[model samples]
Target: MKKLIKLGIALVAIISLNACTEDDGFTFIAKEDPDGLTFANTPSGSYTLTAANADNMAERFVWNAVDFGVQTPVSYELQGAATESFDNITVIPAGNSTNVAVTVSEMMDLAEEAGLDNDPTTAEPNTGIIYFRVRAYVGSNGGNVVDQFSDVISVTVNLPEQSEEEDEDLPKLYVVGNFLSASGYGTDWTATDGVPIAAEAEGNTAYEGFVYMNVDAPQFKILQTNENFDDNYGDAGETDGVYTGILESPGVNAGTPDGTGGYYLVNVDTDALTYELTETSWGVIGNATPTGWDSDTDMTYDSDTQTWSVTLDLTEQEATDNGFKFRANDAWDLNLGDTDADGSLEFAGDNIGVPEDGNYTITLDLSNPRQYKYSISKN
Candidate 1:
């Protein structure tokens, strides 16, 4: 009986050893190792691109097939970068192929985004080496799962010359209806003398400016071009503080002011179909100002001069270094600072330094929509 029991135990040990030895799973490896890829059509030498031939073909990059060590599908990608190490890179996929053709226009965008100037006429010729390499990987989806990179090659690119044309001026916006200095509605009663709001930025479709809306002229609509009843904007009823809520074309349902009428900053965005009204107020606040940065010393606006001014006393000892900034509505939403410390105000810029200290009258001139200026005069 003891001999039979020993034989049974020996048989079980042999079965377990066979099972463990037969469980060898498959492993993945680079078939070509990617690093050994040869570029069959990599462009060499320098090339110049221009807007005249922007749509023309620049180059077609071709590379050898990469093996993912299995029948599972593989993908290829062509990448370009400003640096040789692939830093600040842009990539284009090859679908399921090992080649890609690039256009001059597409290459121009890539060069510009890589810190090259789009205009070659005025700016110096952007002569630098652009690096290119092929990336081979498994799966078509996007992620950090990369397999290998082909040998890198470089080509020099010159900035493309583009034709210079002055940007067309944005159409003007006139205040219509009874919403300004006068109290009357309709196209005939054009508020040409009311207030002209111009575009805040060159290509922006938004216009903004200050308008004094009183209880009498508390409501208004905007007119495009001539004071014709053909087109205008009314209310869209989207949210609070939106005057041009719904557009009313030839029809009229002028929007009303949110709060008591006063000199308010009215901003209109036609593309977004929205309008905003903010009370025009300014204040000087900072560690350098008499009042600390937490609170602002209010500044008053003069309609005649079209400027915001304030006179306050400041001491060198009080202003610990971080100086001061101009804020609107006593809130951080709209603030200006001298980023360059050159006595001019930049929207959302750094704090202004107190060049010494004493009583002084500060004036902010925003008359020029493109150029805003401010002056600190010793009292």
Candidate 2:
């Protein structure tokens, strides 16, 4: 009977050891807390997925725990399906991480699989749809499995339009100058020579005329002409060894002759107009009398032939004794018309008869002011 009791105790002990060993068997229970997190309600753009340990137990009690020696390396995998059964799900390796960039299309797919009409097409069938979702993967020495899925997200895109008036309102460009008026009208204006007159609109100012140039050292040309000759007769001459003159007495002709030639000799008459030009207030270099005028001193207005004549014969004593040298000022005068005519002298044209000097700025103001464009500059 004692031997029987000993054998019973040994069997009991063996059973106890078997029960402990069976309880310690390597069995794993995957516990993913919350199962899934929904990101469909979040804003669009970029995001990062984070892992949360759900178990309150020590790290050793958690199977495939990241802290233990079970070699739990987490990866991510994306899945899209039409239903919760996930029978037709498409699985892609999300790589080795808990975070990944979720695309718009994937978000739309996730929304569709969740039976949610978050996709634009699903909500408004006329439009297209974009879907997205993400799933984390837990890898262990034994095997691997997807832990949970995030909520789905969706978005839509559209383009804008433009108008015609906006395109037409763009700024326009114009050439820099003034616009010319009808041709050949005396009331119209003309531009200075060599200097171009431009029409341009810049900022707030629209320039419609020639720019007034600064006159630095203005100049004038002296014009001396005989006032006692007619178009038919030449200068007064010696007839029968007596000098025949055009001017009668000073009281009789009033310093000008009507060409009948009564008292003073026409050729010797000092009844010509004298024009003076100076360089910076100095005395004139060009001094001449009617007989002393070189060929350069002569000019003719073909349209009004009898209006102007000159001779070169001014003596050096006459020029020195009197301050009769030419003077140059800021202005010039026009004196080539027949003063005796009843407006018969309508037009006048003459060449510039001044000697070539240094550079000068010349401005010609036509009698009508607006008849034509004239240009003058240093050559």
Candidate 3:
């Protein structure tokens, strides 16, 4: 009986050993490594990028590796954007490598996209900052579930100013005329107090603005300065109801637009040496109007106030649907809307907000150039 019991114990021990060796059925759960990544090599100071060193290295971005709980492969990449918020990101693959070397040409492209310009006349600055971050992802996919990102880093880039910038300051002009004195626009309202028609921009030669003239056969002159008439333009061939005219500096006589007199949109070009005037009539159009985007509700022009006024019973649907916009001559060729909803008008901008269903007097004032404004008075 003792020998039989020993044999049975040996058989049980061997069976237990075989069961322990067959533990391959256990599942391994891999949780994303509960850790964050940071820049291991942060570049400091501003870098001046040039075309000469376009092929040279800009900087080397290095980051630490990630262990995704298990031995699962973790892929890394570099992300760059012009904005600090990282909108519109550009991706550069790093594969399994933790470091990425960016060339000077690549950085220049980034700086340019960030609005860095070497031109002195441009509104954009020469130096700007570009943003970057490192992304560590697990497996082959880089989705939100298994992906983690390093803190954003900013690098300042500069473009050297051009030695010779061809563009010079654009010319400016002022409209001086007889209609100004009686209007009480300025203290004197003569050539000295002439309404301005400056260049559209600092480096542009063309000038534009709105002018209110209530004179019969309105006569005027274009002057370079409001202080003096030293540089002035007069009639080369100007006539009433004529939309455009060529002018000669130190001209023979003042410009006589044989107009019945109302508000006119004026445009002057120094390069072309010509002036154009358009008698514009404004209107309102949208889902808010009576025509409901199919047509226009024309507004009447007031010569005294230099405004286009209209009274309409805005639809209830307008308060929920699209609002209205001020367009010229019942056409979308020239339309203005409250882009910022700040009562100021921009071309092809956001639709103006519609008021509650009520009769309101809406005024469109294009008398001010670039500073076009509108008014809404509840009736």
| Best model per lDDT | 3
What are the per-residue Cα lDDT tens digits for candidate 1 across 178-280? 5433322223346454455667556677887655554533556677764463567766555433454445454344555553566666677888877777776
Q: How do the candidates rank by TM-score, highest first? A: 3, 1, 2
Residue pairs in clash, model 3: 240-258
Q: Give the poorly placed runs of model 1, Cα more than 4 Å off.
A: 1-171, 176-179, 182-189, 200-203, 226-230, 236-244, 251-253, 256-259, 316-321, 341-344
What are the per-model C-alpha RMSD values against the true structure?
24.7, 41.6, 21.9
Cα error of candidate 1 at position 368, Å:
4.0
Ranking by lDDT: 3, 1, 2
Name every residue pair that clashes in candidate 1: 235-245, 235-246, 236-245, 236-246, 237-245
Q: Against the true structure, what is each candidate's TM-score?
A: 0.47, 0.18, 0.49
Query: Which candidate tops TM-score?
Result: 3
Q: Give me the overall lDDT of model 3.
A: 0.63
